[model samples]
Target: MVADGIVSAYPVDPEDGPPVGISKDDALTLKALMSPVKGALGYSLEDARQLYLKERIGVGEDPRRHAARNRLAKLFVRAEAGGLPASTLLVDLTRQQARDVRDHMLTYEKPGGGKVAPASVKRDLTIMKAMIGHAIREFDLIKAAHNPFEALEVGISSGGEEDIAARELKETLPDAVIAAMRGNLQGELNLIWGLGSRHARLSH
Candidate 1:
């Protein structure tokens, strides 16, 4: 039954990883990491990784995978129709998102299993905002409007939120480098470019 739903309505091959097209497993991990800022930030969980694996690879499947899969599938179809190749930067962004999600899952709870720094939600938010910025730069794409990632000013700004924001991310390389990916994509790309504009709120 579940497999049928995934195959029919989803319309995505189990191997087609994410909006940018990575391994399905990588997409799933990123989905988990972006869970906290889902609706308010429109962050994607790529939950389909586990579900796809469950249906096709024999691992445990998660139920929430459908939404993310649907979202990416739609993006992929649109991008293909529009003639834009999937950006390598976007693929890298998804990969990083997956890693952060794994880190949060392992570190979120204490030894007994509880929230560590309940007050630091903002800090996490800050990290997320920076990550998004890096995504844009790494992909070397500009946005159509203002960057939502810059507006994500939601993290704990204790002493120097300004300073942290100022800190540079090594992953966000120079513009020419990211722009260099033109025509190298194998899948979909965001309709608009840039970090400040493409951000979506997290509902979960």
Candidate 2:
């Protein structure tokens, strides 16, 4: 959903969950880390990171939140490497700039030089959208018209064909094996089989 073709229907609120310890000193530090002004592109990006930390870290911490923060931090570094100055205004980020970031994520390597999964890249892009949306709708830091991320759609190039192939291979159990399992575990096997079939259908 959207509002006036500007704000998002779902706005992020830091206070929605348990309060976080965003001390005055820390806030000042984050602000200083940003470009002296509030609406600079890097400043808003930093604010988005702060929002994610406040909301996801307030009540408790988990692997998922940790992963999300790390992904965003990595993307920020990539943006800097791509020549976007810390003082770039939020309104100045172009559609091409956003696309460049997506492209970079597509080939991003893991710490051990392993390929990053498409699903992981997709998740990071989704987080980027949410961060930009929150900046626009909740913080009123950037006007929706000036939000470059608003026009972009994140998609894996191969339509997740690799994932489908992996799932198919996993489910191709032999009839004899399936029969033995069903015979040994009648009711449990029935439930499991039904769920597996339902999941396969939904995946299509």
Candidate 3:
């Protein structure tokens, strides 16, 4: 059956002097044997590889490239995951990616302080998505195409209203979290961010 076909593709020992391949007949037999169990570990392949690498070939693992996510913020995380049990480096990398997406969104405006064009909106979202994707890949997180600013159909410069911008930014998290790169809330979508200095104050 199909089970035997997958098993036949399993890597085997090369030092066994070119051992006989898992024949079609044996494949059928293995298929019948595997029908009951699904996705079973056929053999202890991991231990064998480690042993072979240690005994037959001793090689040092690379350190430079695979060390951190970005060279600029390498110090933010650390060379080795210290305090954190599950790879602190990975967590740090994701945080930095989130920050970048925020910074990109903040500065999205024209030189003359006009509205942000439709082109710019899509571009900024794409850039943010690319960074987010990198983090997702690193830690293996599920991602969706849901837009936090779904109602934001306009492109306007935030620098125009400095005071309101500050207030709106704070209201994003309510805990003074100035770096809310991603948000997914239902009802009362914190319109402070979308409005300028005039709408900065909360309606009584």
Error of 3 at 107 (Å): 9.3
Q: Which numbered prediction scores highest in lDDT against the true structure? A: 2
Candidate 3 residues 92-163, lDDT tens each? 234333433443444445678764454454444443344334443432333312222223332333454332
lDDT string, candidate 2, 118-165, tens digits: 667666667667766665565655443356666465555433434233
Clashes of each: 29, 0, 1
User: Per-model C-alpha lDDT, please?
Assistant: 0.37, 0.59, 0.37
Order by TM-score, highest first: 2, 1, 3
In candidate 1, what are the lDDT values of residues 1-204, reduced to their tens digit?
433333344335557632333444444444435542332222221322223334433423344455544534443343333332233223223433333332342234446755444234444444434444544443333431123434433333223233233334234545685566534533445334433223521211
Error of 3 at 101 (Å): 8.8
- The CA lDDT at 38 in model 3 is 18
Clashes of 2: 0
Taking all chains together, each candidate's TM-score versus the true structure is 0.22, 0.48, 0.21
Name the 10 consecutive residues with the lowest summed lDDT in model 2. Answer: 1-10
- Global Cα RMSD, each model: 23.3, 14.5, 19.8
